[model samples]
Target: MRNSYRIALAGNPNTGKSTLFNALTGLRQHTGNWAGKTIALAEGTVEHKGKTFQLIDLPGTYSLFSNSIDEEVARNYIVFEKPDVTLVVLDATSLERNFNLALQVLEMTTNVIVCINLIDIAEKQGIKINERILTKRLGVPVIKLSARNKIGFPLLLDTIDRLVTGAIECQPIPTVYQDHIEEEIKKMEPRVSAIIGDRLSARWVSLRLLDGDEKLLQEITKRLGEGRE
Candidate 1:
């Protein structure tokens, strides 16, 4: 495996995210608990076109607001130690809720790909997803697949290769909020920007702060101090 590329998998629980990760790397998946957190994350490395890429499977959750420990695990990886690219998996049958988490991760990291999983089930349920429309709307590539069948893995890998290597540029889709929140973001952002710089959007960080995630807030504050030191 080449040393240049790294990726992370994130999504809501039962989105077939784990199955996809297993299919991608097979026996290569490594498991361990995150420091100070009992929850575990599985990581693996895969080679595509002579390039080696590391992939981490994060605990599935509906949001990154840290409502649960699993959600915190996903949030931490995207925010502080943002991976090179994050695959946001969405269940074809439950896209609206899945899109929520995807949108949150986009704020933390620029490189994102939406994996629309379980197309088989969706089709049976008469749910038709316009992948092209989803891709255009999110400003990221959308890969439709049924992990169990190993369908679309090659195309997904090819797209990911382009994303991590900079052959394609991913600009996160803009998120809209109430006018008052937008005003607050504009005001609080500069304060956070001094630390995260161009790597993270301060407006998004401010939203996380407002959500009252004390642990994450402390982590950000610590990083800010470390940056200055």
Candidate 2:
């Protein structure tokens, strides 16, 4: 486990997720598609904190539902591969919407860090964000970034260090949905917990399944079955 850490970068479209990946990996990145899917996967390795870290740049998508190849690819990697850490990038200039994806991913695993990018643009637009408040609310490290300018890259690396080394902790800001949804989650949560164990968040898995995220459900079922006798 100490030899290498795999980190997945997930986020919505045009959120500067790829730009950040490029910054982190430089010319080291290589691309390939999912085994049977058309969706492309970009991966690179970098030495950090005396350990080799494998960074996967997952396709940007609005949600985890299997509505498109990109979403399915991203969802499958996180749910099945179970990477060591997932850094969900959010566009600082449009966080109100981009953040929905961050919250969604947090539900999947506690190993999530919210990378808020484009802060330079947000400030120029007169938008002010309290990083401490956001971090507190998300229960995850929130690092500000301007990928183009290479600002906050060190902070991002530090946050990743905390996550991969198990120094930082993430607790999903609890969500309470309508009665029917809550009831459904109640039914699925225990079953998922009994299957996947606690590394994968049961509530998040339930929500993904409820929303017809086949990529996740299929991956979970496959992994769980393998663990059985």
Candidate 3:
């Protein structure tokens, strides 16, 4: 039997996300609209080192807060589908903006890899990023690459292989909110964990609740209720 893994590629628009997807999957990609939504979904398959990986390229979005249909589609797949690894590709020139989505994904799941794309542009613009510092800060493996040039793909694939095979472990540190929000999260986490168990991060669920994300709350409630009965 062939070993297989599922990966989700997420990022903001114009981060070379589609470029990386095309590079990795070549002719093995398929596209379709998301279920009941106008946003498009692309999925492809790639085999590396004798392992088959199914990569789902989510629609580009600024964040996973579901402010838009694209955001909702991306967030739903990462949270509900729970792919083996979620790769957040970021534009190196705009790390501040792109980092927001990366942090949000970290809160949802620990199995994450931060891909810093557009390094060549950053270099031309005289912008420097310390991958070591980023990896240390995020508590996840950080890879710097020019996806357009297909640089660092081997390392990316190796990292994915290790993560999927449990050869490397990831334990992302959750982002700390303000004091009041932290207190609320502490109070709500246990209850959220009781409902969702380990399938989703309790802290993230609590954060969503505090933010009054009615749609996500409804979906979680419905899924938990159905699971119970």
Candidate 4:
């Protein structure tokens, strides 16, 4: 049997996410509708250092809040399917706006790597990114990449390998809310944890519940029902 691990690629649209996917997968990619959903999801395989990494390219969304079907699909996969590693790609020139999704993923999973893509364009635009500072702030690995030129490709793959092999560890920083919201989350977290049973971050789920995410609540109910059956 071949050693294989699943990696999810997530990012906002127009962040060159598909470009990176194409470059990495290189003729080993396919697209199909996500299970029970009309949204299309891309899948491919990459071989690095004797391990097969199955890359699932999730739909591009500005947030995993599930405001749309695309967002719902992406969020469900990350929260439920639980890939070995999630590559959160971002535009190097627009880090602030891109960070919304990144932070959300960090809340949902610790197996994350933030890739600042389009470094070449950012350099031309006189934008500088300090990956070290970003890594420190986000509490996860950060990589500067120019996928079009294959810059940082080797390091990215090596990092993935190290992470999957337990040579490197990721400790993602979860978002902290205000006092009232934090209190509410504190009250609800244990209940959510009891229902999910370590399947997801209870605090994050509690936050979503407080935000009035009825869809997520329904998903949790549906999943639990399915489990019982």
lDDT of each: 0.85, 0.83, 0.91, 0.93
lDDT of 4: 0.93
Question: What is the lDDT for 95 in model 2?
Answer: 90
Collision pairs in model 1? 2-52
The local distance difference test score of model 3 is 0.91
Per-residue CA lDDT of model 3 for 1-229, tens digit only, reads 4499999999999999999999999999999988888888899999999999999999898889958878888998999888999999999999999998999999988899999999999999999999988888889999999988999899999999999888999889778878988999999999989878898988898898889999998888777787889
Q: For residue 193, give model 3's deviation from the true position in Å.
A: 1.6
TM-score of each prediction: 0.93, 0.90, 0.96, 0.97
Candidate with best TM-score: 4
Tens-digit lDDT track of model 4 for 28-142: 9999899888988799999999999999999999999968999999999999889999999999999999999999999999989999999999999999899999998899999
- After superposing candidate 4 on the true structure, give the runs of residues whose Cα lies further than 4 Å from its correct spot: none
TM-score of 2: 0.90
Residue pairs with backbone atoms closer than 3 Å in model 4 (clashes): none
RMSD of each: 1.8, 2.1, 1.3, 1.2
Please tell me which model should have the higher lDDT, number 3 or number 4: 4
Please estimate how well model 1 matches the true structure, expressed as its whole-model Cα lDDT: 0.85
Ordered by lDDT, highest first, the candidates read 4, 3, 1, 2
Let me know the TM-score candidate 3 reaches against the reference structure. 0.96
Model 1 lDDT tens row, 131-205: 998889889899999998998899999998888767899876789899998888888899878867876677888
Candidate that would win on lDDT:
4
Residue 227 error, candidate 1, Å: 3.8
